[model samples]
Target: MVVSNIISGYQKTQKLSVAPFRQMQSAFDRDCLFTEKIYIIGYSFGDKHINEMIRVAITHNPNVKIIIIDPSYKDEKAKKAILEIWSDEIITPQVENMKFGEFLKQQIK
Candidate 1:
């Protein structure tokens, strides 16, 4: 999927004019994909990035869902708090730190 960052109210393309926001929207529209069925996975340095991704995904597809696996950062409590907030979306079916194989299996089911 395409990825981009929102900066100062404007979308800054890290690459070419092939901006991430446009690309992501195109992918979804072309495929006639459903936002609720889509998943965004991230970890570590990706913690904030993943949030940004979800923000963008939701802006484009309001019904989109997200799943994040952020191991305790700053503190365990903070991580737990973030996970709780992440649970608000109805489309989010699961959120955990399972192995890649296990995550894949669960997603497929």
Candidate 2:
């Protein structure tokens, strides 16, 4: 299941453009608004900006559920950042350090 999309992003010139980033932000924002649950898997995303967008999405959808699956739990920082944003508020987000296959079998069921 290798899905892909052609969206505006960084170019080869090593220059940062505002339009593409904003486009992504707008798209993710809309996605967050409509989705009832978000399953974010893996640390391969490796982008702080993208992680921030996820956090903001969680904020936009207060009652939404978030399931984070990252082995080694190295991406705990991203989760911590989200907690800080909504201090004293419990979002009931679940974090798991499990292999993708295990998650599919045990969690998806």
Candidate 3:
């Protein structure tokens, strides 16, 4: 798995004096090249970055299915506009406001 490789790579190179963030980004880029799909899960501040990444990824991989697990979709118009544009491309454009337990249950099923 890409995630496993990421963690293992991090562990192996923790003391290698390289910028871990850059290395991880490179790893993700390489893995994504041949990846059929990607499931990005994030919460809180990470939620912001993940949302941004989703936009960027979707721009590149227009058909890549995305799941925005718990984004703050408080802006109704913005949410609707985004869904209109990206619904077909994403697995679920808005799972943001759902309770974590319910979201997990739905995802598993």
Superior candidate under TM-score, 1 versus 2: 2
- Per-residue CA lDDT of model 1 for 4-105, tens digit only, reads 443323433433246565666456444333456444344442344335455455555666555544333245543543564344543443455655666778
Q: Which ten residues in a row have the lowest lDDT in candidate 3?
A: 1-10
- Candidates in order: C-alpha RMSD to true structure: 7.2, 5.3, 7.9
| Cα-based lDDT at residue 50, candidate 1 | 37
In model 2, which range of ten residues has the least summed lDDT? 7-16
Select the stronger candidate by TM-score from 1 and 3.
3
Runs in model 1 with CA error above 4 Å?
1-12, 18-34, 45-53, 59-62, 69-94, 107-109
For residues 1-67, what per-residue lDDT tens digits would candidate 3 score against the true structure? 1232233323433432356655665666555544656644443322333344555566676666645
The candidate that achieves the highest TM-score relative to the unseen native structure: 2
Alpha-carbon local distance difference test for all models = 0.47, 0.63, 0.50
Error of 3 at 80 (Å): 12
Q: Per-residue lDDT for 93 in model 1? A: 31
What's the lDDT for residue 32 in model 1? 30
lDDT-based ranking, best first? 2, 3, 1
